[model samples]
Target chain A: MKKATIRNVAELAHVSVASVSRYLNNKAKGRLSEEKAKAIEQAIKDLNYIPNLAARQMATNQSKTIAVVVSNIDDYFSTELFKGASNILRVKGYEAFLLDTNAEQQRERELIKTVSSSFFDGLLFQPLGSNIKTIQSEFIHNIPTVILDRRLATKRWPQVISNNVTASKDATKYFLKQGCDDILILSSEVKIASTRRDRYSGVCAIANPDQIHLIELDEESYNYVTIKNKIESFLLKQKVRNKKTLIFSFKERWLLAFLPMLFADGFLNSDQVLITGFSDTKLVQTILPEARLISQNPYLMGASAAEILLKSLSGEDNSKNYEPLIVPAKF
Target chain B: MKKATIRNVAELAHVSVASVSRYLNNKAKGRLSEEKAKAIEQAIKDLNYIPNLAARQMATNQSKTIAVVVSNIDDYFSTELFKGASNILRVKGYEAFLLDTNAEQQRERELIKTVSSSFFDGLLFQPLGSNIKTIQSEFIHNIPTVILDRRLATKRWPQVISNNVTASKDATKYFLKQGCDDILILSSEVKIASTRRDRYSGVCAIANPDQIHLIELDEESYNYVTIKNKIESFLLKQKVRNKKTLIFSFKERWLLAFLPMLFADGFLNSDQVLITGFSDTKLVQTILPEARLISQNPYLMGASAAEILLKSLSGEDNSKNYEPLIVPAKF
Candidate 1:
């Protein structure tokens, strides 16, 4: 069989060769119409044409790749987010490279420096710290990046984040109305990430200061035994005080880790303890059918971030205002 | 701060600049002694030297990047595998790019063709189907590759896989000896992956043909309703026959998806059902404390594959014989 060429695709799609070239280069946003783009895509697919990516990369000075830097990769939330971004990037003729920082700030800084110096077209970052300065210091080459999940202290780039504050506030308000006065906010360290801080603030907004208690787990020292002991102590205290407590988890993994311990200790079925938190999967519901959950659609958040980054890469988004794109979480 | 250069590193380490260059370029296998290598590493760390990967790539015709092709990226098993491989590659100054096939053969073929024609230093592939022919057709450039998880029909490359057959057979034998005669093997499309096929064959070897039954779920249409209905019917049939049954799940996600349904329907605590299969996380034990699990250390398997690929890329492995390295799965 003969190899398909640009001219072949152009002739089959009934478009000019220049139009085909523009579309292949991802410069066809305003130059070509939707109908023409669809026809060209169909013609290429029908002809079984695989464009030479290496040749194209050299010609355009673009690697046609995006770097996705996440805190951790072997988790439910991070993997789903990566999957979402990767799916969109793949359809747009780009590959997403994952860089795991393993939730270490030093590693995150190193990775960001490496990514800034690398030959990637764009970046999707889920930063551990307030990374505006870290990014500004090394991002001299100005690779377009879209921040995911957490917000920076001062926004220098577009961000896609779940509505953590509103969801947590509303959930807390509901619990307050239900006459559950004592509230315990279980979270990972809240200083580094804006997500944890926002959720904590949201709960504190409606609850009494004296009635609210917070336990922050250092991620580096998080273990099954530690979590089990903490939860057991909390439950015992609640039982002695004869007070109903709402256990609000700031992250899904924390909830998943501690819920089993709660079940094992027979604390789940008691009327004194209630549960609610940020969950991304149905696994939480499967484990506790009646637990109120704040569902943050991480996959959708990742896809939206990728779309924004793609637009910025193509010069379609020229706005200077760096307003975040907030994806609402379900209560 | 003054920029650290190769000269500075060599002067600090009391070694020649050429030796430092060779170490940075990953060609210091036999040429540099262990003491010299350690000195060079410490000096580089002390100087905080960041090697220019782009310049090195241009000079050595090495991209310092690897492609990891997997069936799916969103699942726990795949993510764990990728995490392990990525960790090893990063320490070796190579970046691992993930290309998720989404369990599509056509997509896998396209990706393999792309990787073959691209500038990747090596490949770690978890292929679907007996893809020896598919790989050979486009592997004209002979990118050093290491097969992962599943085996190909022909031994064209070194493989790192779990001891699927042995572990499954031993577990099945244990259950058979315990007088659990009726066995239902639940899997996702056994014909496509050797991991599933080997596991199925292992169970078949231990169980009676008349008592063994296999239910294959199409991945595209996998859902709660379908899984729940299938399990309900199987349990009903076992109840009618008054026979004790063992439910063996081939993958972690499958067990996770259906275990909830089994628990909801009150089948978990019944004396008629025994559960065990391939699980990678402690979530299974948390959910069903008594459920026996065959644990495949996916992370270790992935790291082993990356190590093998790195050795081959550095020209340290000259053997032509492709012997498989089996990572033992715990039963």
Candidate 2:
């Protein structure tokens, strides 16, 4: 079997080679239609083609500035990552600049366009839209880049991820071993993202799939009042949690928004309801000492990502077969 | 008095026009000496000169990108600012980028160098260093930029402040009215800056200067444990909790680090010692509702700064006499 190329993908997808080239270069400019994009994606998946990004990187890149693109600059998770990565970059005398996607995929696309034209040495990215073809197209092949906290289908771009799945499994097991009868897993919104999918799977792996109940936060709108009201109704439908019950949340915001509301509704107490989540919030130690949580240090993850990017930027490491670093979470 | 040019400044400072140009353009490549830089600053002040940055901007300007530079991205203050600005910029269709200085002035100098060469349209800055002339020299006047949360001697550049002075005064008066006999001001230990100077002056305006005890937080090292030890020893020295004692902190981190350790030592109690700070922290609401806090909303400040910057960028408001917006803090 021979290696697939852009020409081969274009032939299989039934588009012109020029169109394929434009799409691969992330220069579609909305000219590539949904149908064409789907066909191209399918063809690429079928072909297992990795864009020769490294060759491009090596040719035109003598860069010093590293750009770290995040979904939102203000989000606690993103801030931690930015802090970690920027600190490392600063010590190495490399300039680190930031671009905010505003938590919108459209903005993410726009930012990639802006950065692609800029003189950046490398990239540390927290992906917003998970299209592998789009990723390949927007991210220039040779620019030493590492995808932060995201899992993609293609192994072309190495990633640094916190093992959310293993941590989720361990959190579920801890409650079960403590004689909790019923378990409730609460995640932010309804997304088929790796964080939610893996955490749910990790829970189902140990517990009975039927017994495990999953509740979404107010997915449509992130109104905490709405989420609180929904939780109130949901808890009432269960008709009083008389047995030892454990509720798992995926983010700190959920815990903060739900805990006091639950406490007010007389549904939460130390005796029956045990709450746990994933965060190392400073408030946890002071306010909610009884609640258990898995500390997935995003700072460390960001620093690691920057380190890899800097290594690649320095041309010290040339091998493309970089292993995905799964940062472990602590209970 | 006639207007002074860069040439005039160069002659006044006993340097060449190129050297003055490099300094003003922030193009000084480790060549501008400390003594010469000081002389240039003094010359600018002595001559009362403002660089015609607008003319420069009009001649060589095609800017759609706004670079927001902050001292620290992860700080609650900076995050709120970034969120507010980014949100507004997104709605206005302007590309907003962020650069973190890690709260270091040197890093800020480095970041400015990178951005100046790029084609950014304007700036929304939160200056960490309080050197007004340095700011004037480094910040191009024509970029339609707004100085956020920092005060300067010259009124050449527009500003939007959260009114730390007014807020601090109000907070101090509220406590003094509540019969807080001994008000202990706990500020992060560092060199004198605008925040500290204004806040301290604000506190002094209402209370007896001698009665106000100001303590420097272990600012030299940000090690929370070292701070915890120092605070512990300080609290032990003051055994008299008979009077209404108020511990006023400047930042949230100080409150969080000190409260937990103090609680463990059995030094803090709701009945005897009262706690108050300047933050709108969610945890503060949840944990210590008894504590009084001045909510100087950073989101609103950030949003307002972006609005001002956008207005200037469009050249719709050519008024250099724009009044500084002092966002008032609420209890």
Q: Tens digit of lDDT per residue, candidate 1, span B292-311? A: 78998888988999999989
lDDT by residue for model 1 (A1-331), tens: 3345555777799986446656777644467899999998999999876554432442254668888988876556887788789889889988887777878877777777777766677899888766577756755355688988888766568999988889989999999887786888888788778888889889889888987888887765555566667777987988998889999988787776676556645676677788898988777776677777899888898899999998988889887678889999999
DockQ of model 1, rounded to 2 decimals = 0.14
Against the hidden true structure, what lDDT does model 2 obtain? 0.68
| TM-score for each predicted model, relative to the true structure | 0.80, 0.69
Query: What are the per-model DockQ values?
Result: 0.14, 0.08
Q: Output the TM-score of candidate 1.
A: 0.80
Error of 2 at B108 (Å): 2.5
Ten contiguous residues with the weakest lDDT in model 2 chain B: B52-61
Q: What lDDT tens digits, residue by residue, belong to model 2 across residues B129-224? A: 668866665642244578887776656667878677888888888888887776777786434467667878888898897668777764325566
Please state the i-RMS of candidate 1: 9.5
Error of 2 at B17 (Å): 30
Ten-residue region with minimum lDDT total, candidate 2 chain A: A52-61
